[model samples]
Target chain A: MDQQKLFVQIALHSWNTQIARAEKVFNSYSESEFYKQIAPGKNRIIYLYGHLAVYHDLLKETLGLDTGKYSVLSPLFLQNPDNQESEMPPVKELKAIWNEVHCDLKELFNNVAPEDWFKRHNAMTDADFEKDPSRNRLSVVLNRANHVAYHLGQVVLVKPENI
Target chain B: MDQQKLFVQIALHSWNTQIARAEKVFNSYSESEFYKQIAPGKNRIIYLYGHLAVYHDLLKETLGLDTGKYSVLSPLFLQNPDNQESEMPPVKELKAIWNEVHCDLKELFNNVAPEDWFKRHNAMTDADFEKDPSRNRLSVVLNRANHVAYHLGQVVLVKPENI
Candidate 1:
């Protein structure tokens, strides 16, 4: 494969691996387990799930793939920390949304041509992008993959093996 | 820059970003906090630091950069889980080891040519590498970056902000 294509493949593979790992962690948790904190006073599994979903939904928008569908989650998952007085969306509903958002993203991501990933996304101004082209769509995916891995480590703490 | 160099830059950027984040988290913890669990029964901060150091040390070997100097850490950090009967290295020694390993890796990584990163490393057999070229030196770095991010998240739970 050409260098550009190979780079794209590596980036996508990294992203998918982390996403799959996150899904496996999320799936292992019972609904009751979702209520458990990653640590004594850290974010709960449900909150992390919702936070990831919201960020991914925004990732789609950043890639110019799709406008995010989970805007309602912003206040609860994005703008605030866990254990607020505000009630979270039901676990069942959040789970469904998580699957739906990722499914759509996976398809969209696969279709993007390797060179297209180098283009500036919606989040950045063209002037800034011109100054530093390194802040491209692929960079966002790379960073988000790390973000997922970070939380995956935390949420796994709630599982039986960790304790 | 050529496509190959750009790809190398991106991979190295991802690796370096995670390393810096992990360092920041490690540096933030007081000596006492190193004994705290990420969760109720999860790995402690000190263990995670040693674990990361050992893995990065091994990464040097995998990349054919250097034979690992920190083999002594393997019994405590790599071979056993936290809270074992085995005594841990002091926090000061682990901290120094962590910095030394990463400093050497950073210099070595910078010196490697872009195309060289796509070459197979010592861990893989030639036939297997021919079949699956994706398991190259760069892939190991990418994977290890995520690994660091994972532990970084867990360790950050020890911070006052997260708690």
Candidate 2:
């Protein structure tokens, strides 16, 4: 594969792998465990799940993809920090939207061109972007994947006492 | 910048950002909290820190860079789980090695080229790799970043519970 194409290929694979790992850890949770906090005062498994979905919603906007069906996710889940000043939907509702947003975003990633990826987006300016070209679409994609992995680590602690 | 070069640039930024975030989170923990389980019985904060360094040691070898100073990290941290059959190093000792390993590897990453990143490594075969080009050096780098982010999430729960 061409090197340019290879970047997208590796990135998407890493993104999907991280997501599948999170799904495996998450799906194993009983609905009760989903709501259970990892520690006495830590974010619950459900919050982390919703937290990841919220970031994906941000990714859709940041990457200039079509907006998701669950626009409410941002206000409910974004930057509120867990267990503070917020009420969350039940696990079933959030879970449905989680699946919905991921499916939609994956479709968006499929059509990105190498040249398009290098162009700056999301609040970046031409002069600043020209100085440091790394801050572009590809960075945003990897940033989302990193976000998923970060939360996956947290959710892994929710259960699997031995692991 | 060339598209291939841009891939390296983004990979490096994502890699460094994940590290800086982990460092901030890890540094915030007290000496006591470093040993506290992320949850009831999962890995401790210190274990996750050691785990990341161990993976970077592997990256050094796998990418044909210089070996890290601490081979003991692999036996103590890798796949051992926490509070298990193997004993772990003290937080101060592990902290030293963690910083040492990250500093060394960042230097290694600076020397990598886009073409070198595209070549197959580890167990990949020429034909199999051609069919799945994502299994390359760039993937390994991104894979490590994802790994760090995943654990960063878990360790974030260990203390500063509000964060």
Candidate 3:
């Protein structure tokens, strides 16, 4: 395979690996420990979980992907500090939400026509078509994935030894 | 503080957070998990640990920063299968290397003369810098940070369950 194809494959594999890794981590966590911060003033696993789902929702909108009938939460769910104090769904319920979002994203990726992967959409960035479009999609997808990975690190760090 | 100063502070904070997060995850891992791939045919935690250090080494060279005395590895460490087996370091050694490189990066950030931050280096891309030095620096710094975050995410994703 050529360099571009190699990169795309690597990216897809990276995404798949992360999705499974996250499921494993979240599934293993107890409710109390999942919400605990790894360090003082650091983000907890719940925040990262919410943030990942919210980012996928934004990406769907940005890419104009049809996530039919799925009730993806708004980015505001992760914003607005006052709303953060509100009770979160039980661990199982949150996992279901995460799974649903991932399912939609997987579907979207499956349907992305290779020729259209580089197609520019005005909703995401102001850059013109003359600029490379693949770079844009790559940036968004990679950025979101990285965001999840960063938080997963946080979760692993803070998790109690006994639990 | 002006916008430039604000950006510098943000960049510094991001670098600090990433290193701390990496250290947290690094310390939690067992020896076996460090080299174990969380998923079949996927990256090991040790791969990420080494990759991050190597990437910093590359970026330092790119920006004309000191890379110390070690011979820098080629960028294609991922592609060459032969190199992969022979060059892979033990988890403990990789973590120590990451910590050392992380410190070097922190020191580099601390000593960056504000004027040097604004200085334009010839980028591989066609983006024009003569129009605004501040904008150029912002783009460069943001892009570099994203690069680091991307690899750091890989580290988190590959963490073993027991670790």
The top-ranked prediction according to lDDT is: 1
Among these predicted structures, which one has the highest TM-score?
A: 1
Candidate 3, pairs of clashing residues: none
Give the per-residue lDDT digits (tens) of candidate 3, residues B1-163.
3434433553444445556676787677778777665334455666666666676655565555675433444443333322336556566666676677777767876788755665555454335544533333324444455455555554555542312
Q: TM-score of the A chain in candidate 3?
A: 0.77
**TM-score of candidate 1 chain A against the true chain A:** 0.95
- Candidate 1 lDDT for residue B150: 91
DockQ of 1: 0.67
lDDT of 2 by residue, B1-163 (tens): 6867778778888889989998998998889888787777677777788888887877887876676566756766786776644577788988888888888888787787767887777756789877887788778888888888878877877665445
Calculate DockQ per candidate and list them. Answer: 0.67, 0.77, 0.08
lDDT (C-alpha) at residue B148 in model 2: 84
Task: Give the candidate number with the greatest DockQ.
Answer: 2
- How large is the interface RMSD of each prediction? 1.8, 1.4, 13.7
Model 3 chain A is weakest, by summed lDDT over 10 consecutive residues, at A1-10
TM-score of each: 0.96, 0.91, 0.50
Ranking by DockQ: 2, 1, 3
Stretches of candidate 2 above 4 Å error? A84-87, B84-87
